[model samples]
Target: MLNRTSLLAAPALAAALLFSAPAAQAQISTPAASPKSTVTQRVGLTDITITYSRPSLKGRQAFGTLVPFGKRWRTGANQTTSIKFSDDVTVEGKKIPAGEYGIYTIPNKTEWLVVFNKSTKQGADVDGFKDDQDVARVSVKPYKLGNKVETFTIGFSDITPATANVDMMWELTGAKFKVTSEVEPKVMAQIDEKVIKNASPSANDLAAAAVYYYDNDKDLKQALAWMQKANATDPKFWNVHTEAKIRLKMKDYKGTVASAEQSKKLALDAKNADYVKMNEDLIVEAKKTGKL
Candidate 1:
């Protein structure tokens, strides 16, 4: 029933409004109350990552009253916290395959129940967690920290070559669980292929194999032989220091003194104070033990 002019003008007006709107305002650009954060640490040959939202205490008590004891929590603010492992890992002695999982927990005064859910998208809905989907459920004792922690934090501590402790700290309380990777077999295979089997292995490969053997308490004679080969052509002060230490462990204090003297001379030429000090200490120890 519209006139010709009215109908024609209506289309033009709709087009103008579509072009004039301010592009939907771009989500208002504000900071989140609990900001999302991700932390990653390389544990041995494996990489572990955690993504979560950090919520501050803001003078409110975190445990028992606010979060509630014995109740399953999302382990962080906002969306459920999640973790990913690059390789298969053992968490508190329970094996977890390499994948992503949701982190949930139940906090008590003395200990905590840690849950690694197979579902990465699990929410904090009423009775949302299914026990059948849980990959691991471990109990870890909580300890009171010396100082208060205002913001929740997730990090790694007590790190070694093949293991680390994933620590969760909040509100003067902390809990941790161990994550261990199978590193020995992988490293051994690498050494065999790259150094042992290769007839013409590089000096760097030989050095790497020697260090791995020395660190893992393998055959000292083989380690010493490889190290000596690595340093024979182009002697590095650090490598010579390692040779001295290996000889010392084998109870050859005279050989230790000779290698330490050579290493000290080379360290002096390189102006490396740390190696110089190390060589000096080795020489003193060798002379004391060898009565030379």
Candidate 2:
């Protein structure tokens, strides 16, 4: 019963609608309420990373009204707040194995419970959170801040070679937990495996072992022996300077002056003015202290 023109128009109209539907869907955009952030740091031989979302205060009542007390929070706005540790760590005296974990907090007026959950796949609401999957639960005291924080922030404070504090700040309250990584065991392992056991260790390898020992207040006698081996292999100005420093640590001021002078000669030939000046300063100090 349809005419020729009407028949063709029906198929054309269907085609147009099909193409326009995708275009309409593509025009939609989703804006996140909070932005994502990441923080990474190294504590001794361990690497730590934290990924989270930042939500603004927006002048709302924070503690009791918005974020209810005694209830577990996702510790961020959007996805689950995640923390990754490269090695096993002790959290508030509790040992936790190395892995990625979801961070959650139960806020209180005096103290808060920071939980590291083994299950990392969860939403901001934490609908699927399991208490049995908790790797660690640390109790940390909350401190009232003098200045108001506009947005939620997680950062590392009081950083050292072997330790750092992970701080969470929002509104006028802050909570922190200490993270420590052991350096001595790792350093000794590297020294044993790479320097001592290696059949053909390079000059750089010996020098690295010596520097580690010197920096860590270890046996200066062993460090000096390593430095001597490094010097015999390559005789670099830096290694010679390191030998002078080891001698000074050992209170052998005469040896320090001699090694420093040799370092100065090599540095001068290599056009390194910094090492020349450093060795000259060391020589002067040795003479003043040793009466040489």
Which candidate ranks first by TM-score, i.e. highest?
A: 1
Per-residue lDDT tens digits of candidate 1, residues 1-292? Answer: 8999999999999988888776664457789888999999999999999999999999999998768998888888998899999999999999999999999999999989999999867786657757789999899999998899999999999999999999999998999999998899889999899888999888888888888888889999999999999999768999999999999988899999999999999999999999999999999999898898
- Candidate 1 TM-score, C-alpha based: 0.92
Model 2 ranges off by over 4 Å: 7-15, 121-129, 144-147, 235-237, 264-280
Residue 227 in candidate 2, Cα distance off native in Å = 1.7
| C-alpha RMSD values across all candidates | 2.7, 2.8
lDDT of 1 at 72: 84
Off by over 4 Å in 1: 1-19
Error of 2 at 266 (Å): 4.9
lDDT of each: 0.91, 0.89
Best by lDDT: 1
Looking at model 2, residue 247 earns an lDDT score of 95
> Candidate 2 residues 31-119, lDDT tens each?
66788999999988899999998988897867776778998888878778999999987666778788899998989998899999987
For model 2, what is the alpha-carbon lDDT of residue 272? 100
